[model samples]
Target chain A: MQIVLAILVGGAFGFVLDRIGATNPNVITGMLTLRRLRLMKTILLAIGTGSILMFGGQMLGLVEVGHMSVKAAYIGVFIGGLLLGAGWAASGFCPGTGVCAAATGRRDALFFIAGGLLGAAAYMATYPAWKASGLLADIAGGKVTLGTVPGSAYAGIWAVSGDLLGIVLGLVFVLVAFVLPEGIGGGHVQEMPAE
Target chain B: MTLDWKLGGILLGAVFFAAVLLVKPIGVSTQFVILDGIVADAVSPDFITQTDEGWTSTNAYMAKSSGKYAASAAGPLNYGFVFVLAMAVGAFLSSMLRGGVPLAERRAPEIWRANFGDTPWRRYAVAFAGGFVVLYGARLAGGCTSGHMMSGMMQTALSGYIFAAGAFLAAVPTAMLIYKEG
Candidate 1:
C-alpha cells in the first residue's frame, strides 16, 4: 500500500517536471544566466515544499533520524558535482534529467547512459588500485556532516548545512537568468527589430 | 515559463516518486548497468557475487518464488541498479506519450554535434572524471548531497547543510564554463 502511494506520487512528479520544460537546457541555462527565472523559481518551490514536509515528518516521528546514510569523499563529491555540471551543459542532461531523456528514447541520452555506466565501472575497477595507492587513506571514516562547516563546530552540526549557499546559488542563478538576457540567456531570445 | 507552477510542481513530484515505487527507485548512479554488462563481458563473469546476501529472499519470492526448490532468487537487482533502469524506461515512455518532437539528426545543435562527434570518448571521460569526483566526495564526507542535502536537510541534519554547500561550491565553476558559450 505504501509503495503504491509512492509510485502514484513519483509519476506525477516526473510528468510535471517534464512539462515545466525542466527537461530543456534552455530553461536550465536561463536559470544560470539570469535571462529567465523560470527554472530557478521552480527549483526553489520544490526545495521549499520539501523542507516543510521533512520537518513535519520528523516532528511527527514518521521518519528515521539516524538511518540516513552519510558517506562522502571530498574529492569525489567535488569532482562529481563539477563533472555533473559540465556534463549537463555539454550533454544537456544532468543525472536526473538524463534518465528522463533516456526514457523518452532520445538517442543521445542512450549514449550518455552508456558513457555514465562506463564511468561507474571504471571507478569500481580502479577502487582496488586507488585504495591500495592510499587515495582514501588520508580521510578517516564518515564524520558528522556539520563538522566540515567553517567556524560552526561549536554551533552544532545542523549549522553545517549550506542553506545559505543553496540560497545564494539560487538567487545568483535567478538573477542571471533574469537580468543578463542575451549574453547569459540568449543575448536575444527574440532578436531585435527596426532601429 | 508560463505553465501553472502549482499544478506542475505537484505533478512532477508525483512522477518522480511514482517511477521509483512502481518500477525502480530513481538514481542516476544505477545506470551503471552498462558497467555491469561490460564487466560481465570482459572480466571473469563472476565479478559480481552470487552469494546469499540479506534481501535475496525477497527478490526470489518476488520473482514468483519460481519452482519448488530454487534455493535462491535475484530479488530487485541492487537497489541503485534497479532505479537507474527504471528511470530510462520511465523517461522514454513519458517523452513519447507527451508528444515531444524527436531530436533532429541533421539539425542537431552545434553543441550536441560537436560534443558527441569530434570526440565521442570525451563524454565518457567527463563522466568518468565526474563520477570519480562525486563518489569520492560522497565517501569522504559520509554522504552525497542527495543523501545529505536533499534527504538530510529535509530531516534537518547539520551535516546535510555542509554537504549541500560543498556541492554548490563545486558545481559553480563547472556550470559556468560548460554553459559559457550559451
Candidate 2:
C-alpha cells in the first residue's frame, strides 16, 4: 500500500517538476545566474504552499510533526552545501531534476545520473575515512528547529511557535512569488546543442 | 495544455503534503545509496554483512540507518527504489502525453556554449564532475536541495535555512564566475 502511494505521489511530483520547466538545464542555469526569475518564483511558491499546508495541518492536529524529518546541522553540511551549490551552478541538475531530465530522454541527463551514481559509490567506498574525519560531527544541537532556535530559544528571540512562524513566513513567500516579474529572461527557449 | 508554473508549483506542494501525510518525508538522494547497495550486493553475497572493525557497511547502513531507507532490506526492490523509478515513469508519461518523447535535439544551450564552448566532451566532463561533487556533498550534509531545503525548511528547521544560505552563497558566485559574459 505504501509503495503504491509512493509511486503515485512521486509520479505527480515528477510531472509537476517537468511542467515547470525544471527539467531543462537552460532554465536551471538561468535561475542560478539570476537571468530567469520564473523558476525561482515557482520554487518559492511551492515551498510557501507546502509550508503553509504542512504547518497548518500540524496546528490542526491532522498532520504528525514527527513524520517530518529534519536534517542534522554541522560544519560539514554548510561546506557540503557550498559544494552542492557549485555543482548545481555548473551542471544545472540536482539529483531530483537529473532523474526527471533523464526520464524526459535527455541523454546528457543520463550521463549526469551515471556520474552521480559513481559519485555515491565513491562516497560509500570511502565512508569510514570521511566519518572518522570529524567533518561530519554534529554541532549546535543537530536537528534543531525554530522552536529550539539554537541560542535564541531561552532568550525568546523566536517567541512565536514554530508552526505559526512557518505559516507567517510561508505567506510572505506566497506574496513574493506573486509580485516577482515573469519572463525576466524573455522566456526564450534556447535550442539545445546537437548531440 | 501545459500547466503554468504557479499552478504546477502548488500542485507539487499538494502532492508533497499528501505524500508526507501518508508515508515519510520526500527525498531523492537516498535512492542512489540504495542503488549503490544493490550493485555492491550483486558483486558479492556478503556485501551487506558487518566487518570485524564494527564499522557499518554501506548496505547495512542504508538498510538500517539511512534517513530514507527502504521499508526492508530489500535493496533494489525497496520502497524508495520503487518510488524513484515511478518518478521516472511519471516524467516519461508526462512527456509522452504532452507530445512525443521529450528527447533533447540539442543538449547544451547558448549560455553554456558562450561560456563553456560547444565541445561535447567538456560538457559531459563538467556534468559528470558536477554530479559527483553534488552527491558527495549531499551525503556529507545529510540532505540535498529537496530533502533539506524544501522539506526541512517547510518545517522551519534551522539546518535547512543554513544549507539554503550556503547553497545560494556558493551557487550565485560560481554561476557569475563561470558564465561571466552577460
Candidate 3:
C-alpha cells in the first residue's frame, strides 16, 4: 500500500516539476542569472503556498507535527550547501530535477545521474575522514525549529508560534512572486541567444 | 498539455503538502547514497551483512543510525528508493503524454548555446560534473535542496533557511561568473 502511494506521490511531484520547467537546464540557468524570472517565480510561489498550507494545517490539527523532519544543523551542511549551489548553477540540475529531466528524454541528464552516483560513492569512501573533521558536529540546537510547534520534538529558537510565523513568511513569498517582473528593468526584452 | 507557471507552482505545492501531511516529506539525495550502498554491497559480499541484531555494514557511515542505512541498502525496496525511481517514470510519462519532449528541451537551451556553444558532449560533460559536485555536497550536508530547503523551510526549520542562504550566496555569483555572456 505504501509503495503504491509512493508511486502516485512521486509521479505527481515529478510531473509538477517538469511542467514548471525545472527539468530544463535552460530554464534553471535562466532563473539563476535573473535573465528569466518565470521559473524563479514559480519556485517561490510553490514554496510559499506549501508553507502556508503546511503550517496552517498543523495549527488546525489537520497535519501531524510528528511527521515533520528537521535536519540537523552542522558546519558541514552550510559548507556543503555552498558547494551544492555552485554545482547547481554549473549543471543547472539538482538531484530530483536531474532524474526528472532524464525521464523527459534529456540525454545530458543521464550523464548527470551517472556523475551523481559516482559522487555518492566517492563520499562513501571518504565518510570516515569527514566524520573526524568535526564539521558534522551539531550547531545551534541541532534539529531545531525557528518557532515552536505544539507537538514536535524539536526546540524552537524563538518563543513565537511557528505556524503563524510560517504563514506570514509564506504570504510574503507569494506576494513577491506576484509582484516580481519577468526580467529586471520592467521586463526588458533581452536578446536571447540563437537556438 | 503544458500548464502555465502559476498553476504549475500551485500544483507543486499541493503535491508537497499532501505528501508531508499523509506520510512524510519528499527528499531525493539520500537515495543516491542508498544506490551507491546497494551497488557496493552487491559487488562486495561482505560490505553488508544481516545478523540477528539487524543489518550492518563494514562502512561506518552505513552502519550508523543503528544500521538503518545498511538495512535500506540490503532491502533496496523501501519507500524512498521507490519514490525516486517512480519520479523518473512520471517524468517520462509526462513527456510521452505531451507528445514527446518539447523542442526547447530536445536541443540545447538558447542561453547555454549563447555561452557554451552547441556541442552536445560539452553539455553532457558539464552536466555530469555538476551532478557529481551536488551529490557530494548533499551527502556531506546530510540532505539536498528538496530535503533541506523545500521541506525544511516549509516546516520552519532554521537549518533549512541557513542552507538556502548558503546555496543562493554561492549560486548567484557562480552563475554570473560562468554565464558572463548572459
Candidate 4:
C-alpha cells in the first residue's frame, strides 16, 4: 500500500514537473541566465503555495508538524550549494529534473543521470574521508527552524512567530512572482516539440 | 494542453501536501544513496554491513518505525527508492502523452550549443562533470534542490534559505562568465 501510494504521488510529482517545463534544459538554463523568468515564477509559486499549505495546515491542526523534516545548517551546505549552482548552470539540470528529463527521453539527460550516479558512488566511496574532514558534518544547529532560530527565540527584528513569519515570506514570494515581468529575453524560447 | 506554470505550482503543492499527509516530505538525492546501497549489495552480500557497520546504520531514517508500517522496512528498496522510480515512470508517461519520446537524437538546446558547441562528446563530458559536482555537493550538504529548496523552504528551515541564496549567488555569476557575449 505504501509503495503504491509512493508511485502515485511520485508519478504525479514528475508529471507536474514536466508540465511546468522543468524537464527542458533550455528552460532551466534560461532561468539561470536571466533570459527567462517563467521557471522562476513557477518555482516561487510552488514554494509559496507549499509554505502556505504546510504552515497554515499545521496552524489549523490539519497537518502535523512532526511530518515536516528540516535539514541541518552547516558551512558545508552553504559552500556546497554554491558549487551546486554552478553545476546547475553548466548542465541545465538539477538532480531531480535530470531524472525527469532522462525519463522524458532526452538523450543528454541519460548521460547526466549516469554522471550523477557516478558522483553519488564517488561520494559514498569517500564518505569516511569527508566525514573525518568535517566537511560533511552537520553544524550550526542541525534541524533548526524559524521557531528555534538558532541563538534566539525570534527571527530577525520583527519578533513574529516562526509559522507566521514563514507564511509572510511565502506571501512575499507569491507577490514577487506576480510582479516579475514574464519572458525577460523578448519571449519564451520553445524547445523542439517534445520529440 | 499543458498546464500553466502557476497552475502547475498549485498542482505540485497539492501533491506535496498529500505526500506529507500520507508519507513524508518529498526528496530525490537520498534515492541515489539507496542506489549506491543496492549496487554495493549486488557486488557483495555484506557490502553495506561491512562499510556502514550495519544495514540500519546508514539507513536509520527508513528503519525507524514511524506512523507507517512500510517506513520500518530495512534495505535499499525503501519508500524513497520506490518514489524516485515512480517519478521516472511518471515522467515517461507524461512525455509520451505529450507526444515526446523516451529518447531524442538532438538533446542539447540552442544556448548549450552556443556556449559549448554542437559536439555531442563535449556536451556529454560537460554534463558528466556537472552531474559529478552537483551530486557530490548535494551529499555533502545533506540535500539537493528538492530536499532543501522545495521541502526545507516549505518548512521554513534556515538551511533551505541559506542554500537557496548560495545557489543563485554562485549560479548567476558562473553562467554569466561561461556565456559572456561577443
Chain A: TM-score in each candidate? 0.64, 0.86, 0.92, 0.87
Q: Which runs in model 2 stand beyond 4 Å of their true positions?
A: A148-159, A183-195, B50-73, B100-106, B109-111, B114-117, B180-182
List model 4 lDDT by residue over B68-174, tens digit each. 21122235356788888888888888888888842333466556666566777878888888888888778777789999888878777878887898889988777
Chain B alone, candidate 3, TM-score of 0.92
* Kept native contacts, fraction for each prediction: 0.19, 0.67, 0.73, 0.68
Q: Tens digit of lDDT per residue, candidate 4, span A31-111?
A: 787877777888888888888877777777777666777777887788878978888888888899999988887777778
Measured by TM-score, the strongest candidate is 3
DockQ of 4: 0.54
Runs in model 1 lying further than 4 Å from the true structure: A1-10, A63-75, A129-195, B1-26, B31-43, B52-80, B105-149, B156-182
lDDT of 1 at A86: 47
iRMS value of model 1?
6.6
* TM-score of every candidate: 0.63, 0.87, 0.94, 0.87
DockQ of 2: 0.57
Query: Between the candidate structures 1 and 2, which one is better when assessed by DockQ?
Result: 2
Give residue B35's lDDT in candidate 4 (0 to 100).
71
**Between candidates 3 and 4, the DockQ winner:** 3
Worst 10 residues of 4 chain A by lDDT: A149-158
- Candidate 3 lDDT over A91-168, as tens digits, reads 888999999988887878888899999988888888899989998888998999888877888898898988898899
Tell me the deviation in Å of residue A81 in model 4: 0.6
- Which candidate would rank higher by TM-score, 2 or 3? 3
TM-score of the candidate numbered 2? 0.87
After superposing candidate 3 on the true structure, give the runs of residues whose Cα lies further than 4 Å from its correct spot.
A185-195, B102-107
